[model samples]
Target: MSIPDTASMPMFLRAEDFSFSDEFSDLVEFSFLPGRDDMVPWVEYSGGLPPKSLWGDSICGENTITIQSDMYDFLDMGALSFVPSDETLLKILETAEHNRKCPLDDRITLGDDIPEFNTELCEYTLTIARSITETIFTRDPYTGIVQEHSPPYPDIPRFKLTANPWMVSTHAYGAAFCHRIHLPLVQRVGASIESGTLPTVFKPVFKPASFRRNNVPTLTCGTSGSDVA
Candidate 1:
């Protein structure tokens, strides 16, 4: 059976009003997964792995590291600390002294003086600071004017929704129908039948000469009948 083009058809039926069986609901959910290929589960790995330190212990081969779960609980209110190494601590002190002498809004400007700070850590810290500044200040860089950060409106695709809600919801039901329903039905029917050929009821009508044109070329006799052209 042929299905009508849902895109060309008007949406007389709203999805909310439609009733579906539990089995159909399960199938719809299964179909939805394939459509959303981009979606990944939040928890990728089942096992928990302990964090490793940047510098490996050269002398004792064993360095005991303990992490209190509460300290790094970002999801909830918790206190975090920066326990720097002896080397990093010295660099931090130097940077603090420099800041006290000549304070700068941008941490990146202090990079020349603080050579001990790792490139990766410096970039990461600067990036975070810049992002925070942009959010808090919300200023026009060219004009040097501070603007209020306006609340962002919901970015819904109005045109696509208005054009075809059904197509958008089902990711075009034709693909889902063929994969989930029609192909499976054909396979089942094929398996049941003893004969290799499909049943007459399932066969489509064939017209061998359907494409032949009615117009045909005819030979015209010359004015002089004696000469056969």
Candidate 2:
């Protein structure tokens, strides 16, 4: 399936590959561990999956397709403090801070007087602090914004949900995480730049080749020891 300018994107849990219905599905469950009670028990499933469609590294269900990680990064408990995957994010920040764009770059610097935090996201108004994170993305005062390299805490990707949503709540997790990094950093960039402010919104553009839709579609996939209610 050739991708258009935009994807009518939906979220997923244990996603394998993309599908028609997954694009339109309203929500996805993400959990860090098994036996978590956060999923909606499905009485009926509906995604126009082509014959033999599958999701993720494996299948998701009998009739559903797993969303491609290429298009989306599925987050679960692993992505929490455990996964610690933020190098890519920091590199992206360095690029934006130095170049005023999101291309890759090596010219990173840490500001001599950066603010400090000693509390959890729950301790503070995260939505406001998140604006600071967005600033890290756009105006990164810290030149060497390497993850876990110089920290009391690592620069990992995570969320401060009222609930512990993980792989199952992939939609909620992804959207919230996206919102966390996307909005705050962009907002900070607008306020930090010496020149005119840039757009305080992050718009990720998927590569062109990924839109190819000539492949097969219907998928049978799900995590082992897990069942859709």
Model 1, span 1-229: residue lDDT tens: 8755556743221111111111112111111112112110100000000111101110110111112222112101111111222343344334333333432232222123344343222210000111122221222212223334312312211110111111111222222233342323222222222123222332323335433322211111111111000
Model 1 misplacement above 4 A:
1-82, 103-110, 113-115, 119-229
Please give, for residues 20-60, the per-residue lDDT of candidate 2 as tens digits: 22232333433332221221111011111221222112223
lDDT values for all models:
0.21, 0.25
Clash pairs of candidate 1?
A: none
Query: Best by TM-score, which number?
Result: 2
Per-prediction TM-score, please? 0.17, 0.19
